[model samples]
Target: MSAFTMAASAVGVKVTTTAKRASAKRATAKASSSAFSARKASLNGVSLAAFAAPSVAASKSSQIRALRSAVFAAAKADRSKADDPDAGKGQRVMIIGGDGYCGWATALHLSNRGYEVCIVDNLCRRGMDDSLGFNSLTPIRGIHERVRKWKEVSGKDIELFIGDVCDYEFLSATFKKFEPTAAVHFGEQRSAPYSMMDRTKAVFTQTNNVMGNINLMYAIKEFAPDCHLIKLGTMGEYGTPNIDIEEGYLTVEHNGRTDTLPYPKQGNSFYHLSKCHDSTNMIFCTKAWQMRTTDLNQGVVYGVATEETMMDPALINRLDYDAVFGTALNRFCIQAAVGHPMTVYGKGGQTRGFLDIRDTVRCIQIACDNPADKGEMRIYNQFTEQFSVNELAALITEAGKKIGLDPQVINVPNPRTEMEEHYYNAKNSKLQDLGLEPHLMSDALMDSLLKIIIEYKDRVDKSLILPGVNWTESASVGQQLEKAEKVKA
Candidate 1:
């Protein structure tokens, strides 16, 4: 053969080899895509086994991301078909703790806004009231009655699932079936006093709060990684920091290096500690699984009425004024109604963030309408105003006087082991920027809330108004105080 003929032959072989490799790459990509689709089909109860599952020839991270994306897409399609025709127009959201104080109100709020809502709860908080021999100052209807009343009042439907989130199988099934566009999580134990009541209560709180959230994160990853998880974290997670608290992260400069990290947490109670743990888990998951999350570090929620909740009497939300579940203002207002003096703990200088219930619902709506990007963990300080315990008591006293309740403010020995004085300047601009017109604490709101309290005054148990749980090692301090008050009487 001539030299030119040999070179031409070599060039032809090289071209054929290059073409073959390109063909192989295309085949691999196709196989990987098909295997992912088949897995998704199987998950959604579609039998697509005829397509052989092939090992995805991609990086480990790429394969995982692809699998998650496919699973979520299939789940979303399945959920869309199961929902009402109108549900497709609006985003479908699931509330994991949909039966509690905030959860119930949020369901009604979102439903009124035309979003499809599914509420999941095991009624553990209600059970806690029974276990602690405390009841809401206001009469609360059962979940079934509440849902029925919501439907009757607004002509909107809210799907309810009665189950524990700690049950992974149950949660997984719910996620698969609902395929929510977002999840508003409020399903954990939320009381600091209750958690510190006893060793058993402490263990239950930690396990219930942490494990349930972990299970939720896993279920989201496996079923719907794209679902924006809007967790109801407490401002208590940041405690009473001396420095101004950032939204959810802080920037540090050390050794000529600057890095941004999650804000330093200093939760004052076991309940708050559990929330910090959840935040850590979420941050890890956001990085490891590329999951999207929004942690709304909410302050103490006050007030009762919302647009949807006020539609009917039966649709009213639960109002707790006991030491365990009741907030400062709620308990104070109820106290004034029953002619009991406002029991201010310590010097009552403990200041914290606050928001009206009406605003809380609004904030959630804003968060839902605007979702976080994949692998992004968004945090919003979710309160409109701030007040010290003394200021709240004074406000309640002034309102009580207006209603002829003759409320008096009295200072009592502090039951819990928190600071009476601390700096709390947490930035809460994120939610406001999202167009949250805050309902500031005003006398009109106070008067309205007092009227309801007065109407339910007959049902108020004065005995349950006092603290039952002490944060210190000696749990009997609260009991001792109760006995002393009884003797003084």
Candidate 2:
């Protein structure tokens, strides 16, 4: 007799060898009633009823415990499949700000990887461009056209939902209909310069970012509580500090005590401040409601080409170089292409973390593949390299020189009040351990980016590059608006 049979015999239970083995099989098959029925129907050509009858003398509690063990074994099998690439073959993913820069790229990346992707966007980014009197230097295709092009290129259909995340009704309805397994949230005002442009923008940023996140959390809680949330946080949430910045926490030793807390945030702009607020609410959600979230505190993403975007011209991602939405390195690439000077602000010693756009999508994929546990909030500082403003300008200038553009580098007065030079170091080993091979900034990469910019240089509106949005309190808002109007005209 096996150990199981011996144990049952020792329990003062009348058990034959056949019945003992059948009881074990029944317990393992309890995950499904049909499986249990099939296993219990026979045992070594004998009916299970022979042993399961009340006269068999097995306790009801023992039978119950055996069934519980089967259920747990089945659950463990299901969880083991979560890490497989084929596991997400039929799972749905919803991209909240799918029409914008990061969202569009991520949508394509996920879609190509065999996920059912649905994109929800209000197109507020484009609307903001209209209000600010500038546009992406490269003409971005309309949503319909972009989606159509993607389908043509890859034969993968991506569903589009035109709506605002702030509208709770719309979000709830979306959550009900799609029932996504994962959500990538990029649906908020993202530009610091735009948020600080005026009081109205500042308020709008807070309302839109904070409320949208809240509604999303509630929608998930009510409709798809098990869905993993991959929120796009910003590195700007933690401003330059004297000490090395950890992923999302700092361990401090005080008088006879030690505590680990969320790293202190000192966002210089209202947009980043809104992100800080979002972080707090997410932490609360995980603690209070057992929600799962992975907040990617990403750095300034540069470069425009991705594996999908480079496949076809129509699928090109948005490339912005204006004062409001553009990053420093992207703006530098466009300036070099258009024969404009690489505008370095102040002493140009301001340093920031950056990653190529390709890595951005890859990082999101890694996040989805490795989900956070329920009641856990995982944070990853998403960047590969760091460079100062002057260093980036020099790199762009040199790349331009090699291509015969010979780009001019000029020092411009800093428009925003920020640290021109600061001590900065941040740890980012978490994502690296999860299999993210970063695409570093290289001359060949710059050469490829410049080539694309040169193709669109003819569409460059030099005047629109510098909108007169002053950050200093002493600067007259009226004068700034008037100057912007003149430039627009």
Candidate 3:
């Protein structure tokens, strides 16, 4: 009989198996019925980023195919403690959008912890955001330049790829070439306002986000079936829910029949709707193909930099404060830089889960090491705290005033479509159980981000702060406001 059957027959005793095939790790939950919680007290940190992912310079496309195949075959074999990311030996990791904000930081953070990392992107943001005449407030260097800087600082080379995930051939080729043991995907169009601005933006979101993700799954199965995939999904995918968010799944009783299913996603805008579509597609693939995947329904992430990027100004990734891609905290901090009042949309009572970039790295690392079983899919709500937009704006105003910026708070006519105020509560316990001690969005972290903006205040383009992306509700109002936001290219 299988070990699973043995555990089932043990009667009131749970048998857990690890890569080591050691004793089960469990604790009886506080439930009256069949409830069990599993915990791993210690997981070795992945120690591969600097030397692992970028094993060697890419040879010409015509060569090194055999070497790449060997590496991939090794990755697909049943894993052991030696390959565990948590073992302080870090996995060979690939971050699809490693040049983007969260992706860059995550790549570096894991590298510092000893994981080998490779970044893949088509620089699509440059294409999309440039057309809108907005630039990420801080200048972003190309991937080659970034790899050079990383090597100079940490004596490591983060493999770089100028490939598009939307292209199945490129994606499949990269997976075969790198043979990464794990991948963290954060490449997606992520702007609610922009997606609602026009049909083109909406179509772009749907086409690019879904296709890119689907391609990744296909490539993983074809090239490296054992690699763990930790994909970044937005909390906005859940929209403004009335109940506490469960960790990726929920149980409901319908007609006295109870079943657990993926939580209902209530997306508000086109961008968010695409993320919801992504989760649905990922779930279908994971269950059908027995692929290992972790969907992190993360909330809006704040804070300026992580432990990795602060190493040097040259190492910093894109920091967008304009309306197009700017998140709330980033935008508010930028407004303070230009002496502009914090822009409050509508009544500004919409609440969202928020996380610091530092904790974001921790969360990602934890998920990578402790993957779901082959036939089991797990989801985690990735957020630490919740705050309304108004509350956050007030905090920025207060923080800016202390720095002598005297930043004001202005109630702007919300150009795009969304609920101004809504309920949002999500559960994020599974990650904690996996040993994630979260880093809260402390005011100190806020100040750190603000001070970075302070140093770069001269580079602040106040005009880009609001691109006036409008929705059906206020399309005409947005036309007039759009003229006010573009200062220059």
The best candidate by TM-score is: 2
User: Residue-pair clashes per candidate, as listed?
Assistant: 0, 0, 17
lDDT of 2 by residue, 418-451 (tens): 8999988988988765556679999999998999
Ranking by lDDT: 2, 1, 3
Judged by lDDT against the true structure, how good is candidate 2? 0.80
Better of 2 and 3 by lDDT: 2
Model 3 CA deviation exceeding 4 Å by range: 1-90, 473-489
Candidate 2: segments with Cα more than 4 A from true spot: 1-87, 474-489
TM-scores, in order shown? 0.79, 0.80, 0.79
Candidate 1 Cα deviation (angstroms), residue 117: 0.6
Itemize residue pairs with steric clashes in candidate 2: none
